[model samples]
Target: MLGAVFVGINAWLPLDPLKFCISHTDCKLVILDAERAEKLEPIVDELYAEQKVIGMLVVNAQEGKGQWRRMEIFDKALQNSAAGSPPLEEESVLAEDEALIMFTSGTTGLPKGVLSTQRQFLTNVLNTQVGPRRAILRRGEDLTPPPAGPQKGALIAVPLFHVTGLTSYSMLATMAGMKIVMMRKWIPAEAVKLIRSENVTLAGGVPAMVSDLLDSSLVGHPLEGLFFGGSPASELLASQAQVAFPTARLSQAYGLTETNSVAVGIAGEDYMMRPGSTGLACPVNDMVIVADDGRVASHGEIGEIYLRGPNVMKGYYRDPDATSQVMTTDGWLKTGDVGTMDEEGFLFVKDRIKDIIIRGGENIPSLLVENALYEDARVREAAAVGVPDRRLGELVAAVVSLKAQYGGKVTESSLIESVRKSLPPFAVPVMILIQEKPFELTPSGKIIKSQLRKLAREHWELRQKNIPKSARANL
Candidate 1:
């Protein structure tokens, strides 16, 4: 195996975050498309001067687009450099060597780079690859190989930079000899067509995307395996999916970037039986629900979830303090979600204690949005919370109490327009509620997000009250 660590950067990142990561990771070479290169044109010289990125290989470049210094066309570079080069001497690849780095948002506004070792990466692949296959076999499906004609396909509607997209979809599909079909963007009608045309065997997306796909008239039973993640799927949606795709094995997985992709999963009939639960822990992993008093919770008791496994991350890249904060002295990672482990070991994710809003499976840090709002002089205090929506699992929305002097002068639309310039389109607040009162606070004077979340969800529900119940169900 090559001994190079690959940093997965979101292709949709704006210039500020893109530059921050390029410099933070001490990246040397970057491979991007011509359009992305054009986006970096203004800071090309600055990046080079700071030695953040010394070289670039432009993928999908036009004939005259490789004019940037130290930049080469991807195809030409591959052809000229590796045409006749001799194979290098083999080196031993250690299991503990760093393999992949992915950025994840936490309580802090900025993203932290979560590092995974080779062993951890491979373990995650095995965890995902084996779970569904065994589920299929346990259900009495024939294991005999079909005659070699067309390869089975995995339809990927998510971004490749994500842990689920890269590890679960791309790597697992490649290892299983399945054809990978990636969509540039998610369009339910197009996704349905691709499933039919490509002989897709496995396909899935977040609950919100799946909701949209199920509502679309174009959807039909396609894949043998159907999985959902990003956020918990409601009982109604899971029931809807099972009814629509009777032939497919419906699955739901639970984990974060720190766990590679999945730590617990449920599929098939078991998934439907307990649609509210995220399922049993992986056989090779250790999971326990720790109570508020620092002891293991009894069956059906809610507590903080803790996970330990070969697939767990090594640490946050170059940030031991942050890593230590999340990990116990015994090595178990403290997943801030409160959940209960039933007698059967199925995990019910009752609540997420973290202030991270997952919109369509993408983690949006509330602190990040709050920081952007604070930049405007009119914003006295702003709390960004997840607003429930039928289409997106949660949409980023803010409640702002302006400074006394600027209270009546500021408008919600103006504040949203100001943040759009800095944050990515998806990260921008979709709804900004102008409030006159301060947010509810805890005994320690910290903003009570649980209270704010309730308010946000209620606001969303109230706004949709006028729509017909049948129409609102799929909105």
Candidate 2:
């Protein structure tokens, strides 16, 4: 069995553990709860028959009698002479450097395999020192660290499987000797309760989580700090966060799985000064570089982001060619994000390169269109995509979910008109579809544009098929 400690901190704890084992053959599966043990019986029985059940380590079994009993069964099953080998000590497992395979949120596609070495894990942990610590030091205040206690630790309500939740809060908490208070899932009330009860100095989440907390009036007090990222937060949301939590420092960061949470963050005064910038690059890892073409775009000019430093993965597992596509020989990884850097080195993300819509010869940024739709009072959430257009090659299309309070106040034509007024005529969406429900999102709360594109294509095809005979003939 592989020597690895599985930090079980996700809502789908048992399923993740199963997937972790399946992805990495060497790692011994550690089930933290008896609830997990109960769920694993059928699967374990199947694996046992296949001679795959090697060893077991069940944590916190004493908390529940049934759980303890279930763990004992698992323990005994593995301990039987026929079961092969005994489980090794936790230190023995930690001694060797092993592959840690983590699953992506499967937001845009099937959760891709993310593999990092134990060295990479330590590198990423060390990388965290560059951002928050530097920010604190630059404050020119007293340099003493916060007193060790429950309140000093970050309050992490999100699950640990996610890169942001895991790195920003969980792993960071561990490094700081901070206690983690987790919920089965995010409940606004429960989050508030924990913040107050535990005196959680820091809380981390994406924009949607913050929006949910703000949507309800239950969060009535200021927090120590509110850290958000994984998706863009509009100025409206940023302002609301400030209004709601006057004393708390509000921040946002940008990073991807390949970087292992090499985050770029700007908060407090920086957030107020430049609401949309992703702040300066984290010093722990040199995460910022501009592509050759975009290098000369000037300050605030759009460019493809290139990342360099220890934070980048060695390469994609078992796909050297695919890995080579993103990694540079000189140690840079093309991030595929279109962004701009200010004279002061603040990074502002414009849109994703893949999501850019080329309508005729014009490059229409889908994020701008999405942001426009989001600004509409009637729109609750929106996603913009490029759909095939025989005449223009590609046309702008938007899918939007309306706010319940709007009561069908806005129509497709009205939304089109709004875009026309704000943007160039060619940039206006050629098609707009209203959705009663919000778009499906990843664990990080990023809208699944790929899914939305599929749905949009189907919707447009159906609409074309239903066109009147006269209209079709004219076309």
Candidate 3:
């Protein structure tokens, strides 16, 4: 019911329509903190377009113990919304329409509003086979369900705006009539505490979030299920999580906003066998191939990923040209992922054609390099990109994060040594940058290579500026 804490500080633009839609629905009350009101008022003004009385239930989120501040903020926001605005008049808008409008992370520029319909939202939630479905099956055998009632509830820590957090994982939990808990903001330590205190049954996050939880003490707590999507989690991390949370089902999937949520996921036993695979196609979804010459790729051959399902979006809002670019006249949505299916129908993603790098006649898949470096205990995260190289046209470069045990030291020599020990020399990154922190990630936890490329270019330019003119001439 339009309940948020310090809304103004969380000024990410995409949440307005979603919040508005929720407030207009069964959730009418608006609750926010008084200290946050000054900031949130502008947001409420932007989101609440109707000319009606909206009430407030304000509390001191900064003061008081526990979640008192948040509780108060929620109380006040709901009260204000209900008391202030009368229910919005019915327009031509469909009753089953426009449930939420979230913006993309704006990788290229400003975020664009992605409107989701109620039917769309409901379909994503129900189709998403979340939590521990059919009990925790281990060793190809079914185990007993965890104690039912409140203990079986789920946790939602990721921000509500993201698709994984809102559309699939968390939304599925909410639709199941389970109690949802979240921190006023994401604090890994706080999330751990919630898991223990709330007896959380399932936790959903991206790879980065999963990595952070693994790095945190939270993994020690009792967890029944751990599912992540939006970005690929390394096989190393997935294995480690399974070992740590023996009782918890650990799995990952592949999907995009245009697909509504997850169109494919690895479940139970299959999750372990297909380490790098994106798992089998989800129920009611059809995944097929369209080759380079408009012919279907044979089984076991790589081709563009295409899909037909109810989960497929109703095309981008107000952008017909953009819609036609991805969707065929026959209704199959061409996902840009390059992949192949084995005889058994498990999909293995080779690489995105757009993301492949050609360097000195060598083809480098950034995902491969990133996966290798992630296997190292000292490496928290890594990303590979192509940079200008005079002799080779473009050279592969890597940015990496080191674990605390490594004393914050990331050296090119060490990484080079590691890669050389495992991969061929051509695939090894020539330039390794040890970042003090993890590379900046998208909301979905993907390493923003474009941002990394920009930073790398700047760093190279700065280094060049420091070199003496005579040194450049001599070189």
Candidate No. with top TM-score:
1
**lDDT, each prediction:** 0.82, 0.64, 0.62
Candidate 2 clashes between residue pairs 3 or more apart in a chain or in different chains: 2-26
| Winning model by lDDT | 1
The C-alpha RMSD in Å for every predicted model, in order, reads 3.8, 12.6, 13.1
Model 3 / residue 322 / CA error / Å = 1.4
User: Per TM-score, what order, best first?
Assistant: 1, 2, 3
Tens digits of per-residue lDDT for model 1, 164-244: 888877887887789999998998889888888899978888887778768776356655778897778888999988787
| Higher-lDDT candidate of 2 and 3 | 2
The TM-score of candidate 1 is: 0.93
Worst 10 residues of 2 by lDDT: 466-475
Stretches of candidate 2 above 4 Å error?
5-96, 105-108, 147-153, 217-220, 288-297, 354-475
Candidate 3 C-alpha lDDT tens digits along 1-475: 3212111112322244335333433233454444445444555654344533254455665553324222335555558879998986555545355555544422222233455565665667656773234224445455543365664568776655566766777777776667687755657788888877876878857565666677788766678678866655666767877877777877767766677777777755677767777777777678886688888889988899898777776665555666787889877888877898888777777765555444533335676567668778788877777765533445677777777678445566877788765444666877667765555778998877787766655555555578422111000
- Estimated TM-score per prediction? 0.93, 0.64, 0.60
